[model samples]
Target chain A: TQLLEQSPQFLSIQEGENLTVYCNSSSVFSSLQWYRQEPGEGPVLLVTVVTGGEVKKLKRLTFQFGDARKDSSLHITAAQPGDTGLYLCAGVSLGNQGGKLIFGQGTELSVKP
Target chain B: IAGITQAPTSQILAAGRRMTLRCTQDMRHNAMYWYRQDLGLGLRLIHYSNTAGTTGKGEVPDGYSVSRANTDDFPLTLASAVPSQTSVYFCASKASAGYSYNEQFFGPGTRLTVL
Candidate 1:
């Protein structure tokens, strides 16, 4: 059984401040995906990182996959009130078929105006 | 495109009752999945269908069953609902046409409570 551990389950930051969320695991993965979910809604994909040590950016968000493929991180720049929501990290195990995904506990970010 | 839609936005039923959650997708994706989201457990896959006439078990499939008789729908069934089964259910679908699988598109989710 593979498990992904996410740090700082809860975060409250003021608008304009930068913050980072981390996801760590001992098992290697073929790909990692970040998702943002607002209240009462299912999660929506933010980014997908497939290579070790690779980084991808989406507007004010940056995502990085660890060299070992066992860790990943999400960094938000100049956070805004609209960014408040739950952030989730999901990893796809190597050689797994049908695109199965393993998810982390999630980070609840509350960006205050 | 109504990417995906789930029936009965919210349901509350007495323990031991049978319940079936309906999920329909419009994208004609080859893969469909069912998951349950708990307060701290994140999303745990209950079942998945790679395509029509094929289904597989996921991490938490102890008390649930799923069927995929066609390409557009996957339904999850609980023979006898238990309180512990109360959680938000999400259905997701993605196309599988190339080497890399696509990110899943999720439905709004259905909230179920068994008392």
Candidate 2:
């Protein structure tokens, strides 16, 4: 089975602080996606990176796919209270597995204003 | 339009009781999915249906069942609820337009507590 492990499971930081969350795995994936979930709500898609070494930016957030497609990262610049939530990384394996997405445990960010 | 909606926003049930979570989408998506989220365990897929009348088991499908009778609804049933099955359940849908990647629209989620 393929598994994606995320680092710094919990993070608490003051507003304006920058942070990075990493997702690593031994298996390679064809695509990786980042999602943000607020309390009591379902996750919302942030971005999708399909190529190795690909980088995508959305407002204050930046996402990067590793050179080997086995890992990915999300960097938040000047995080604010609005950025506090659960960040999840999900990957689609080489075959896509009928559109299945394997998810990481997730990194919970608490940004105090 | 309401992209997706789930019934019984939250539910409390006793062990061994049967429960069904209803999901409906307005986008007429071709694929629908059911996922359960637990503390420290992100979201695990319980079941999925690529199209109407076709369903398949997902990573954690042992205690659950799903049916996709039409293009817009996919309901999940728990024959005998267990304490371990208590978790936040989410319903998602994708257009599956043959693209390598697509965004999945998710519902607000249903909070289920089994005791």
Highest lDDT: give the candidate number. Answer: 2
User: TM-score of candidate 1's chain B against its reference?
Assistant: 0.95
For model 2, residues A1-113, the per-residue Cα lDDT tens digits are: 89999998999999999999999999999999999999988899999999999999999999999999999999999999999999999998887656688899999999999
- DockQ of every predicted complex: 0.61, 0.65
- Each model's lDDT comes to 0.92, 0.93
Q: Which residue pairs in candidate 1 have backbone atoms (N, alpha carbon, C) closer than 3 angstroms, thus clashing?
A: none
Output the lDDT of residue A81, model 2.
Answer: 95
- Candidate 2 is scored at a TM of 0.97
Tell me the docking grade of candidate 1. Answer: medium
C-alpha RMSD values across all candidates: 1.2, 1.1
- Model 2 bad stretches (over 4 Å): B97-100
For model 1, how does the per-residue alpha-carbon lDDT over B16-100 read when each residue is reduced to its tens digit?
Answer: 9999999999888988999999987889999988888999999999889999999999999999999999999999998862234
Q: Which portions of model 1 miss their true places by more than 4 Å?
A: B97-101
